[model samples]
Target: MATNSIKQPLWAVVLLLPTLSSCGSMAAWWTDIGPSFVLQNASTGLLTHSLCHSNNTPLYPTDPPVAFKTKYAPKNGTSLTATGWYDTMTTWASLFYQNNNDDIVNAVYKCNFETGTYEEIESDVISDRSGTPPPNAQTGLSVALLGQQEGYRVFYHDRARALHTLKFTQVENWSYGNPISTSTNRSGLALGSMFSGVRNVTVVTPKDVANIETIRLNIDNAWHITTFPTPLRGSNVTNLSNLTSLPYDTSSPPPFSLQGWDGNPKAIGIAIDTVLTRHIFYIGTDKAVHSYAAFVTGLTESGFRAQPDQSNEYWPLADEPNSDFAIASHLGSSTIRLYYLSGGQLIEAKYKNGNWDPASRLVVANTTVFTNNTGPVEEDNGLSTGAKAGIGVGVTVGALLLITGGVAAWILRKKKSTTSDVEAHGDEGASTTAGGAMGATQPASTAQSPDVASQHAEIARTGSGLSTEKWDTDVKDMALTPPPRELESPNLASELPQGIDRNELPTKHHITELP
Candidate 1:
């Protein structure tokens, strides 16, 4: 009897031990905390700086040093609006220079970020050949990027008034070389300002080639042979027309397309989040920001396929019209930020979980127009917003653990009398028969360990509360101001460009006429 009583309690303890240890396996909870801080110029206070790599190589001062300013001069009483940037992110940044002086012409220029200047890199100057008279030239540069593998990949708009893709490899610098001779007026198709996978998309136009029907560079042939129109025929690129914007498809469709997007013509190519699953970012078109998702595979000719099937839907962006938008991904968060020129000043908005939050103004320009105000800016820095948020959550979790421990102790003590007496009575008969065992197993020392039922309750309350509290804290902190950075400067510029001779610059929009 004595031995059985001892074994029973020991067995019970063993069984309860597993239940207690399992408490640590609770579900993990996370929430989007957004950017910890937004750094801007003290003068113009622009949040985004248009980013580009001069040679696909890392440079000094600007980290990899891939972006540049959109400075321009007026011609014949007309604003010669243009956009320029270093194209690739390698050791050499090919400059995508667009001289949108009403002709939709482009030239690849090589820029030296170390010296802070540029020179025309390409021998040929290419212009849009839509065969239709030019509607104002697309303000942004076109880029054809190489994916990670050796193959031909093209990103351009087709005649259906939609964006299209043709995957091939082995092409290099088709934009500068004038490789394809199609007479399509597919002007302003440069590599996207952003990256997808291993390379940027390549843009090209047919150079008066006959019988070719379709024009695409053969990437496997080193971009030298423009004969391989195989992918174009296989896909939808065979008969092209009405191509609008060129956005890299980063969706499950393995190169999802951004098609039929027309709103703000200036809203050309927007930046995308390379690290995000949804990959949300903004591009300016008709002065509005359009959102996109990358890496989705189910997209077909009919549009985004249904999920389970991963189907997609088209949402019209009517909010914040007439403002140019530049977006960057907030590191490690679902939040995508949009920096735009609005109300004559710089402003920002954050998109998360498919919703565009209200716009927050970042710069104030109540008066004079400034140079470098032609486009929005962006940057990718080494600072960490996710880490700061993690630290905050850790502190909260630690506090919760401490408090739960104290509460568990209080509960145990409150139930101690009944639990201890029951345990003592159970052992008394067997212990008294065993010589001197009663004193050895005194009631004080033999009190039952807290019940499993009580422990489960404690865990349920603590774990659930901790998750909820953490989420609430994250949402609240999204509205909190971000920290300051030493390297980042405000987008605001106090000085105008050197070429802006006071007499030459437009004065307060004195009703100008075209040439």
Candidate 2:
């Protein structure tokens, strides 16, 4: 009877076909319904709106009010507790802050110069225990966006008053390795009042490569610079063991030391020029903006030259008590911008074409407009929101298609051995053809100019723009001599060591007049 029933229907089977087809169609439509809604919501949410559309007012509706007031805002009073950098690749401003609670937070925001609108894509706390327990006011934060891997590296002082660094890649969350202990006891150095008081931190990667270097004042009351090669390639962690300290004359004697000026809690700024020259700006105890330059020649006697004597002029806010400064440089450009707080307003100066334009004092933002308290901020002349939305949609669709196609291919291979065999054979021929084509298209080596060749060789030998071989040699030579005893007072301005002449110290350069 069952066999007869199965045979009964050419007509019946034909009639049932429409219903089965309809069911399949309904299933497909049902599967697509959820995604359709998601796409709609995502598109609408990402649509760009102008914050300054109505008037030429600031982007934030209320001054210093939390929701979307530039890249960062201080929760408390007018001390700028935030710093930001512009990412050219992403066209977004990445901001980091030490909030009122002493927690570290970072956010990425896009600005629309056309519409004057600001949009935040992501914001989250970087560290909950960012040296808040005792509330160290001098514990500033520094962030460097590594162009090689499109990731961020952060440096800060922890609650234990230790110097620590952490990294964040697009694929993974923030991960930190062992903190570099800056304790005088651990380092066998005398760091007086600057213990755990981090005035500033700056990081740079020369030639846009993996060789990362950082300069900061540790608990030892001295500015120390360290370099790490391939900093992003390790077991998802920074290897501090490879850290090599650079030379800075912060010894105990009056002639060698800047008399602990490097340890000041005011502010310090570092920038790399187009030719890989490093410029360090700091506020000296004399209330002057002191500047120093390090040429990329091998790290020998002439590695870094101090122009302290040249920096005699005072900056607008540089001499003000409790004032801090920040610096930013355009990638692949000779222009460097300096920012500082003056009368609760953010001001800027530009260093371009071999001169610092102090008269280019542009008012970046008024702290009173957003809040009464001062906040450190960074700006970007970014793209429109509509452009960003288009990019976001395209990326989302591409990802979905890739995932769906991969799943379909996997399922088909699992269901049919014949299909797998056919694909394997095709892949083998394709791979062989690709290899032969690649070999055939290989170009002959082009000879580089003598100047270019020499530059490349130097980069290879030193693993950086600055050669460390001679510097290492100098260190080894110094190690042969007996170490100096710890100074009774970290500040020994009154007591001058014999046979040392302070007049012969490296001269400074005017901050705004630096070449």
* Model 1 lDDT-worst window of ten: 18-27
- Model 1 agreement with the true structure over 37-60: per-residue lDDT tens digits: 111222221111221121111111
Instruction: Give candidate 2's whole-model lDDT.
Output: 0.30
Measured against the true structure, the TM-scores of the candidates, in listed sequence, are 0.32, 0.43
Among the numbered candidates, top lDDT falls to: 2
Model 2 misplacement above 4 A: 1-74, 77-90, 128-138, 148-150, 184-262, 298-304, 308-314, 317-319, 341-346, 364-515
lDDT of 1 at 183: 32
- 329-430 in candidate 2: lDDT tens per residue? 432234454444343333344555356544222211111322223212222112123222222221211011111223334435444422112232222122
Which predicted model would earn the best TM-score? 2
Clashes of 1: 81
Least accurate stretch of 10 residues (summed lDDT) in model 2? 22-31
